[model samples]
Target chain A: MSGIYSERHTLEKTESASETANEPVKKGDTAEVKESVAVNKMRTEFAALAVNEAFARAAAAAFFSRLDPTVEELTEIKTAVSEAVSNAVIHGYQGGSADKTVVMECEYENSGIIKIAVSDCGVGIKDVEEARRPLFTTGDAEERSGMGFTVMESFMDRVAVESEEGKGTRVTLIKSLDISYYGV
Target chain B: MKTEFEITDNILIAKLSGEIDHHEAADIRSDIDGTYAAFKKKHIIMDFSGVSFVDSSGIGVIMGRYKKTAENGGITAICGCSEYLRSILYMAGIFTIVKEAKNKEDAVKLVKRLEAAESGEIFQEEKEAE
Candidate 1:
């Protein structure tokens, strides 16, 4: 647990620094102050179990609710998160070893942009391009639709994947909430 | 997820509720398959009025069932999907293989009509009426 926390702390520092650098310097503007204060992030790790898929989705939805996204937007985010977490549990861990952990991190900017990353240190994908193809899956044909990556790509504004064959896989999903719907 | 089954004129109507993700899809697949086989139904109608959320796993379940029924010369129809779910299904090309109905009744009627046409019963009925 300490190791995970330390890793998360390092990630948080790096993200915050980049965010600060990208932020425009606007003096005496309340909106700018509010925007800077709105940046928030969360990270959690759980066992790579099938049931955790639901947990992961709910957690993401709850965290993002501060943005006051519309029902459709929230549903899309939840579905995309579910796909990423499911891929981690089913494919990353190769049948969901309870001992393995899947880490999920979410960060939101005041500008209505949200980014989510799901990672697993399991048998990494050998061919990411092939894996991203629609209807391409190495799992049981009867049980997998092979549309996880496709769903994520369609539902989110951007989807990125990084993996090392023997190390792990990390999927990052980004979406921008409707500006009118942003509460925070 | 929860599924309730009803048989009408030999068509299996499965009423599905709750979120359909990988965690629940396994149970749903088994439930639908078990009921379909046990009842020896020739066609199936999946009612999704109560389904709140679905991911690719839901698509897989539908595809798997469609393949099973199609191999046996039967058909599959889905009804009661919310707008989001319908879009997902359409994106997955599920509508190419599975029929979409307005509701459970429409699905049953559609399957019955198709079955009648397949068995030439509609022609017989027309001739008898004439």
Candidate 2:
């Protein structure tokens, strides 16, 4: 089961903004404030498998570790990640289709904010709004509780879904951190 | 996730350990539901002390068992959940029907109480006769 999803992920891109604070201030002159900005981004692909749900959550938690999120925050992120990945694996692929891949993207900013996007190039949702409703699931009632989107909305600061019928679906989740909690 | 089940006095005690996600939900659900059916237990007590994480799929597993047990005039109780896990379960509106406990012993007592209440046996026969 574990072999269905690949662990190899690339650190696709990295961007850093650095400013030197070497400017001498003169009397009656305004001094420029030097600011540094760091952006971290990563993208990974996984097979549409039920077992990879754990792998997605673990990967997201590790990516957000640099922000030093609290236990609650960490769990929230993990839950959201799990939901998104599960949706991709179960609904998007509509079975254990190993040929398709679910992609996960993680972005971190120095501004104490993290944005994650889970996308699948599989059968897209026909009605995203209806699907987002609580207790709205297309899967078997005996198997699904239909609270995936509800859980994601509750755990994340912001949630959005973009999908096209027959193309695929993309779920974007953003969370703002209280840097003070982690003393970051 | 791994689940261990013990039956005593018609109560099914399920001790779940490890992380519960979509990957583990199916197996765990089958195991719990299968055991609960085979034994005809009157109540279920889920111990979450060993659980470190749970996702929405986990809720499906929990709700399925609760619904099945409720259908048979049985009650479901969960115990030993961390604050994080409790909050997640709470947000999912599981508390509307399910009960929570601090420990395994309290959970057993809760299930017993619920069972009695379900059977209208909480009040003594003399009280009811009066």
Candidate 3:
């Protein structure tokens, strides 16, 4: 699990932007955003237990509710979070050891963009490409659909995977809401 | 999650309620499989009306049950899926193998019709039309 600590350190380095919570951060004149935007971030670590799956979804929903996302968008995000967390529990931790934990981080900007990352310290994925394929599960055939990555990819705009064979895996998902279309 | 089972005309109707995730999948599976084994029913109808949420694990549960029923020379039908659930199931290609019914009654009717067809018995609808 030392790898998990290292991963956390790296995340902290990149998350400096969230240090000024609720404060408007100035963005460079980029096509995505030209105005200063309020940014919020949340992070949680929980035991790699299957029961925590529902908890994780609720946490994400509650945190992102400030955006006033549409019902459809909310459900889509929750489903993607569930898939990522489930992968951390079932595959990353290899059936979930009590000592192991899954870490989740969510960062949202008023610009209608959200980034979520779920990480676990366990046996990491060897073939990221194959794992992303629909119905390519290495788990029990009868109990696993091997559609975790597929579902996440379908629900979110982007899905990124990082892993080491013996260390762990981290999955990051990002989605941008069309707030103007929804009039939110 | 909680599941209620009703046996009618040798068909098992399972009404599942609550969140369907990996944590609750084992219990659901045992409940359905146990009752299925006891009744020796050939067809199953999974009613998802009470279900609030589902992930990939739910897909596994459905696929596993579908395989079991098919192996026993039976079929599986699902009814009362929310639109969100339907999309997820469709993405997983579950609908290609498992029939979707508008409601529990429709599912029961479908299974009965299929059963009769398999046995070379004329369904009442066809008989009446004749």
Better of 2 and 3 by DockQ: 3
Judging by DockQ against the true structure, name the best candidate: 1
Q: Is candidate 2 or candidate 3 better by lDDT?
A: 3
What local lDDT does model 2 show for residue A127?
93
On a 0 to 100 scale, what is the lDDT of residue A11 in model 1?
31
Best prediction by TM-score: 3
**Superposed Cα deviation of residue B30, candidate 3 (Å):** 1.2
lDDT by residue for model 3 over B88-109, one digit each (tens)?
Answer: 9988899999999989988888
Candidate 3 per-residue C-alpha lDDT over A61-128 given as tens digits, one digit per residue, 9 for 90 to 100 = 99998888999888989899999999988888888877889999987755577778898888999999
Error of 3 at B52 (Å): 0.7
Per-chain TM-score (chain B), model 3 = 0.92
Which ten residues in a row are the worst by lDDT in model 2 chain B? B121-130
Residue-level lDDT tens digits of model 2 in B45-92: 889899888887767777888888889888888999888777777767
Interface quality of candidate 1 as DockQ: 0.76
Candidate structures ordered by DockQ, highest first: 1, 3, 2
